[model samples]
Target: MPYTAEISRVNPSCFLFLIDQSGSMSDLFPEVGCSKAQGLADAVNRLLQTLATRCAKGEEVRDYFDVGVIGYGQNIGPVLQGPLAGRDLVSISEIAFNPAKLETKIRKVPDGAGGLVEQNFQLPIWLDPVHNGGTPMCEALRRAKSLLEGWVVAHPTSYPPTVIHITDGESTDGDPSIDFQKKILAG
Candidate 1:
């Protein structure tokens, strides 16, 4: 049978996000009418919020997940801002309590009359757009492997970590497949 372990405070999981902050990310995404970096930052911030909501229990947010975001460009390290800055992996409760800021955004919605209406809502922001340097994907992957390896050793019985890599272009540093296969996929 497949692994059916429940994700809870005692047996939590991990989410490591690898974001490409290369100069190409500043290019506009025609579909969204915004820079690729902006779109990516929005998506990651929204996902963090959703994860925090999922781990909420009564008055407290449970430590059901350890999260990290690494941005590769001129710098390849943790990119989470506010209280999460300079940290690699943090608990879900820390994410729930430490957003950098909140911004009001407008969205288009369908009205009953078949017309579009504008709606405003607050969105918690954790990461901002960053575009610079080369796409050092291989280095980023290696960094992720190091972090996940330590996490696995600490939480051997927990669910395997999930990595979400978002890149706009190819790696400018080196071949990422080699490191990924030899380091990440080996275990």
Candidate 2:
């Protein structure tokens, strides 16, 4: 099946996270007792960490992926922090090299005897929580499509880029479906 493409350092895949950072995101998420922005930020950061870890071998981190965190709100653009602050797309190795911050967190896990044990883990973050202006999802999608088109051109033989778009299911801008469909057919 075409879905069975081999994933390796030489022929890696890509991940693009399109996060919603609109003012509405500040609204509390009843399930988690936190804002939507917090949830989105946490998800993006964790995904980046996981991807880097997946490419880790011994003490070396390989370039098995290219990742992006695109936040759309007051401004629509790449939202990575630290050394990768302004970059739109970066290799997995680059993300491993540049972390906005490292946070020590306590996690509980089950022991072999079914008892809980506490462990500390150093978590890395590339994007922070931001809840500002209106949701410009249309513009963000347009930008992502353009970026993906370029990526496909560059890595035509590699596994197709995977875009994980996290939004609040609302579009302050007009319906993006019109442009979205036109581009889909034209492409």
lDDT of 1 at 126: 89
Give lDDT: candidate 1, residue 99.
Answer: 98
Q: Model 2: which residue pairs collide?
A: none
TM-score of each: 0.93, 0.91
Q: What local lDDT does model 2 show for residue 127?
A: 81
**Top TM-score hit:** 1
Candidate 2, residues 49-155: lDDT per residue as tens digits? Answer: 88888888987899988888899999999999999988889999899878989988789998779799999998898888999999888999999989988988988
Scored by lDDT, model 2 comes in at 0.88
Q: On a 0 to 1 TM-score scale, where does candidate 1 land against the true structure?
A: 0.93
Give per-candidate clash totals: 0, 0
Which runs of model 1 end up more than 4 angstroms from their true locations? 110-114, 182-187
